[model samples]
Target: MTTNNPMRTFDDSRRWATDGTAMLTTAIEQLDASGIAAGSQLPGWTRKHVVGHVAANADALGNLISWAETGIEKRMYASTEQRNADIERAATLPADELLTWYARGATALEGAFDRLTPQQWQHEVITAQGVTRQASDVPWMRAREVFVHAVDLGTGLGFADLPDDFLTALADEIRVKRGLSEDDLRAVSGSLPDVTAWLAGRPHGIADAPELGPWL
Candidate 1:
């Protein structure tokens, strides 16, 4: 069967994923013990929640990598309940412990990336959202997480600071997700970053940007 995830063919996914991981690592390094307790840009979630989700996501995506490697079905999470529970549990970890998991998870995921054969990259896998996709899209999926969540951590980084290619890709992706046409996106009244934020349902700091929808 063919994979339908739009990012499946983005060859820059792996490199951007690496950059995103490093980007978060830098931000995480700047946060002190008390920093995790602070509120992030994402409503109702603290920095700890954001960090925990990033760490958990690495391990979850690893399951998809394993699925590709062995041609066996491995769900990203055992269950949605289990997924939320895992993030909560990670959130309660000591600052150092959580940081360790953050680093370790990325290491393991990247290791898996290195190990996958060219043939394995074409293997079909399921996303947490239940979409069928090629393993090649896994890095892009991870890229979406680390980069966006890094901003959600309220670390002063914003969409404007993201790599040009990624922002361009993200605007396109979110546009499709929001069911807006190219002209529709063009009609948004702001800079690319602000418009992208509006499309993703984040606060665009504009006077009256239409609330498109929640983050995909």
Candidate 2:
């Protein structure tokens, strides 16, 4: 299927995934009992929900990685309801258990990636969104989830810690997905990270405009 993205390399995606996971893991590790239960920037989602969602997402993406390696159709989740239920169950765990679950899920996905040959990276896989993309997209997709959700956790971590290329690409992608253009919105100005965060519907201390939304 056609995509706006240009050609991407396995090495670039892997590096981003590794760095993003490291950032997310550090943020998750810092959360205390109260901190996890605290409200996150995402309304109605506590830090626990954010953490739970991220962990569950790793498993879902891992399924895609498995599909790529074995040529089997491993769906991301059995169904949307099942996916939500899984995250809810994860959200109930205590902080230590939660961290362990998150770590395992992330590591499992990484291991799957480690096993892929160069040819497998070019294999087509369907995303939860139902869009078909290359296996190479998996690492970048995971990177987006981990990095953006880390910011959603509402700890001190912000978009500034994310790579500049990621932010630029994110801004472009979100603008396209949300049907926004430079002319449609005000001439907003900020650092690349803040702009990316704002565009992605995360909390960013930038010039105010109309609320943009439910960014995944």
Predicted structure with the largest TM-score when compared to the true one: 1
True-structure RMSD, every candidate: 2.2, 2.3
What stretches of model 1 exceed 4 Å from their correct place? 1-9
- Residue-by-residue lDDT tens digits, candidate 1, 168-202: 77888888877889998777678778877787777
lDDT of 2 by residue, 1-216 (tens): 223375334566687788889998898788789999888888988898998999999999999988989999898989999999988887788988988889999999989888988888778999988999888888889888988887888888889978888777778778888988866534776777877888888878786656787789
lDDT of each: 0.85, 0.83
**Local error of candidate 1 at 108, Å?**
0.5
TM-score of decoy 2: 0.92
User: Worst ten-residue run, lDDT, model 1?
Assistant: 1-10
Each candidate structure's TM-score, on Cα atoms with residue i matched to residue i, is 0.94, 0.92
- As for candidate 2, its clashing pairs are none
User: Residue 39 lDDT in model 1?
Assistant: 85
